[model samples]
Target chain A: MATSAKSTDISKTDFGKSPINARLSAEQKLKLLTDMVRIRCFENESVRQYSAGKMGGFLHVYNGQEAIATGCASLMGDDDHMITAYRNHGHALGVGMNMNECMAELFGKATGCSKGKGGSMHFFAPDKNYWGGHGIVGGQTPLGLGLAYALKYKGVKGAAMCFMGDGAVNQGCLYESLNMASLFNLPVIYIIENNGYSMGTSLERSSAFKSCLAERAAGFNMEWAQCAGTDIYEVRASVQVAMERAHNESRPTMLEIDTYRYYGHSTADAKHNVVGGYREREEIDFYKKNHDPINVFKAKLIAEGVLTEEQFDTLEEGIKAEAAQSAVFADESPYPEVSSITEDVYYEVDRQTEAGRTGKHFFND
Target chain B: MALIEYRDALNQAFDEELARDENVVLMGEEVAQYDGAYKVTKGLWKKWGDKRVMDTPISEAAFIGMGIGASMLGIRPVMELMFWSFATVAWDQIINNAAQVRYMSGGLINCPIVIRGPANGGTNVGATHSHTHENFLANVPGLKVVCPATAYDAKGLMKTAIRDNDPVMFMENTLLYGEKWEVPEEEYLIPLGKADVKREGTDITLIAHGRAALTALRAAEILAAEHNISAEVIDLRSIRPLDEEAILASVRKTHRAVLIEENKPFCGVGAQISSILMEKCFDDLDAPVLRISSIDAPAIYSPELERKQLPRPLDIVAKVLSIC
Candidate 1:
């Protein structure tokens, strides 16, 4: 593969010696490692499917940003709500969406999570408390606040985690949502995964102020934090703190996670720019070879003797097999019937019918 | 039955629905302490308290999207757009998210949200404030557009919109707010996609909606007494999922049809009705379908220009009598 020249000039963020000194037990570390690997393998297979033209539509692979989703989702219980931007395959997997359903959705099949209509950008599973994989830049922020309001209204202590990219930080709705969330003390955690670029535009080019996104939280009087998102433990700690603040004090928080995406904005972006359209190929290679979330976790677990080499090998093989089976399931699943289009739009009960009936005679003779 | 103004009937419906359904809530600019721009939400803040009747910031897109999200989470939200013109700002959420969620999810989700506001130009509110968006929303597939012309229909349709499982654009009229009518002193819900026959005759069928429907009825009365043209008048309460059956049946009896609308003639509700008539009742027609509507220019602020911009009762009367 031809490598871009900028890759040589780009400096990687220093991976500080384990941000939190707290050591997880062997079982917990193994479980986290397995989760990360499952997401990595799943998304890798998705990219393969995209390359083969089997997965149509926009394919936004979360190859390099796995740690943020895995770490954050680990803190959420079944009752809490999660909404995120279009780069959402990893988040959907983290929230426990069936692999078969996720793959089928990408394949635009009836058995998919969104019944094949949403494709990749608009997947939603309310039962899982995953509101959506919303495509509109900062549109999901207010929705997250609304979900938190509903939970508070129902006297539930569940928090809503609203995720967006660095590029969406400038949307006017984000400011409005932040104000509302703070004014009402909504239990919401607004996370911005600062991946350095919005499509082909770098954060430096698009954002006037790039260093501290969390600083904007003060304008809304929100609690704020920043962390190295490449480290699962650091990401987990930051999310846990925000979750606690939201649950205990009913205060909203903003967490800025410094992260990156290994793929181009989408599969279609040639990713070539005079000033460097895509990140240096070497930078992607470095992340994929060394700092890959799955590899880092796997290395840590194996070095700590959390699992035998044989067990890790078996886990990888099993995950690969699972991903392959899901592809088959998606391939064989049928497309939604045209007649099914009109269903589920409204809930019509007898009460509405009776009410409509009485009003009928009002206009009748 | 009691006589109440359209505005008061709407207020009563909101108050009663909020009290009856704990899941029902209200949100919009000036809906809380200011009592709504049109005062249709008056006394609701005090009765329902601040939580149920929320006053949102000026971000229409955010609040409307929030309403959609809240509805999906089992809450029935009655969102006021302040004016129907502001709905254009939130079209993305309305058209892409709310309208398509149910079908996109394959029957997994129901967007039971009501977006209600006063539409049409009559109060001389000028171009910016005055707009009739029923035609624009009717083109959307997943939405139900309701334009209620009377106090009875306003209350009934609003209640039904709140209870509906899909997103509904409940369009009211600024001029009709003070108009009084007899309404039953109980809960009622007029089903969507049903038309109401305001008057029955056999000479010509005049079909309209919202304020235009009232104009058509008035025109029907005038044509009956003066021109000796007994025109049947139909109020298409809902624009989407149009009551084509009632319309065709009326046209069959009358043999001639006149469609009236506040929207411009080009791609307006009148055009849709005309197409439906042509397809369903072409063989039974005694004459071609005549449509009365505003010109395609933006509504001018000048009083004379505004008057010329609006489709008047005289326009409906002239079209119906001419066709007869």
Candidate 2:
């Protein structure tokens, strides 16, 4: 099992020094970089739009933790699934959700993915096998297990990657999910994106763990690993091992990817990132300057002679233009009409079955 | 038609639906090898095997949420909560994930899961175990709540709830589980949001659900025999879709209304129905709408007190005479 090599406590490992798994073609490597750039640029533009009062609701952008979603999604098969907490822009884009629809959703437009019904924290695309951007902390944990349960129930050799933040580590339901996943031997990988902070509170102050968070999986007799989230290669290597365990053995794995986020909890809380803030300015800069996933990967690709600086610049420029184009699309899209407020509440309401047609489902009607 | 206990009627619904659909699965504590706590899922595990009828740990939130997750991917999961009162632990999963998923997804997803268990207070199970959540569940916009008072309604609604393309909260009564009533052996589905007139009269409309509907029916008989007042009993099989037209039609004809429920007096199902009657048929009513809810208190541990705490036939009769 690759669990021995991949499941070490690598929270203190150097981001750029992790052993690289050079199995991807130059095109695939470039695609990973392109996806991350698009996610970063899309969220960057979303913050600007939020500042201009063009968006509504809490906006949790995925700025620094790009490698986790991009790397895990790189290994997803057709039967594989993904679900994450509210900070899910990276995962959504990683699974090939359209930038236009995602951005329009931020603008609360009719053309958005959820038709503007779900605001910033509730993005969903079942067609893409992306379950949702669930708002509740640790609430999606069991759902992730359920998705994997469905896979095993249907005899499909696929895994569900359920992602949550460090703050969710202490939620009772997460522990309940851990026990069920192990007892049922379900094919699920519970991915903990440890960004050090859960909202304004640090992990040290929030969770009471013995060693690291993922080590708690030992209580459930499940496999666990920790990796540097800044290194996409390491992220992919660790998640690949868990996916193999799920596909071959139909087992569950708990992964703690040690990552850092550049912004506050949400764009609404950016004001708390000052010098004397809940976290320090230097801590943020240290990660951005040394461990930025994009920069570290760009340097690695250059060292491998797979990407030239000029080609990299062109790819980035194209990505920037696409992100900007999405903003323009969102700005031009119309808001959903008031009549559509009652539209998607129930499946039968839309299907108009005899039961759905029999009574007044909506009190407003 | 044949006489069967409410539990067996439910068992028949599970048996027929499992035979009818390959995707329908039943999972909960003791549902499999243990034959279910209340035996509602009796013999299902042996019939369908482990893949279909499975046993989960005593974790309500985890299993319930897991069922919701599986239902999203085309599996019709029938999650059995030992008691609807235990749903408090998994309340977020029911109200947030299962209920709101389809709406939040803009119809991109469907959570066709049924979380069913007994939710009554007269069993002397104490305050924590005894709870009627139909009122609480019906308040949510994206959920459908069903309460069956008779074996026929239990069989028919359980079938329809299984086939529904939305999340359904099915509430049963433990005291009514062993009670026998005639139910058709043939396959049939009772549409939700439609009220059943258990007894028809012209003087007053008695609106109730689940066990309270049975109480209202008994009260209707007494009102006819002793008081010489003809009362119509409306059993609200489904709470949310609410059969408001039938309620309005009955109230418009009867001219007086008395709503009864096993839920608490504050914010009960009767509260909403009373407001609906006042707003829609105020001119047609000869008197103000009345409500006979469980005494505004917790479920007592003593059997006698607990029996009186829930809505009784006398409570319905007394409330009816107040308006008559």
Query: Highest TM-score, which number?
Result: 2
Q: TM-score per candidate, in order?
A: 0.93, 0.97
Best by DockQ: 2
* Per-residue C-alpha lDDT of model 2 across residues A188-305, encoded as one tens digit per residue: 9999998888898887678777668899999999999877788888898889889999999999999998888888899878544696678877777877887898998888889888
Model 2 lDDT per residue over B1-324, tens place: 689999999999999999999999999999999999999999989989999999999899999999999999989999999999999999999999999999888899999999999999888879999988888899898899999999999999999999999999999999999999999877889999999999999999999999889999899999999999999999999998889999999999999999999899898999988888878998999998999888888889998888878888887888888878
Off by over 4 Å in 2: A1-20, A270-272
The numbered model that scores best in lDDT is 2
Per-residue error for A99 in candidate 2, Å, reads 1.1
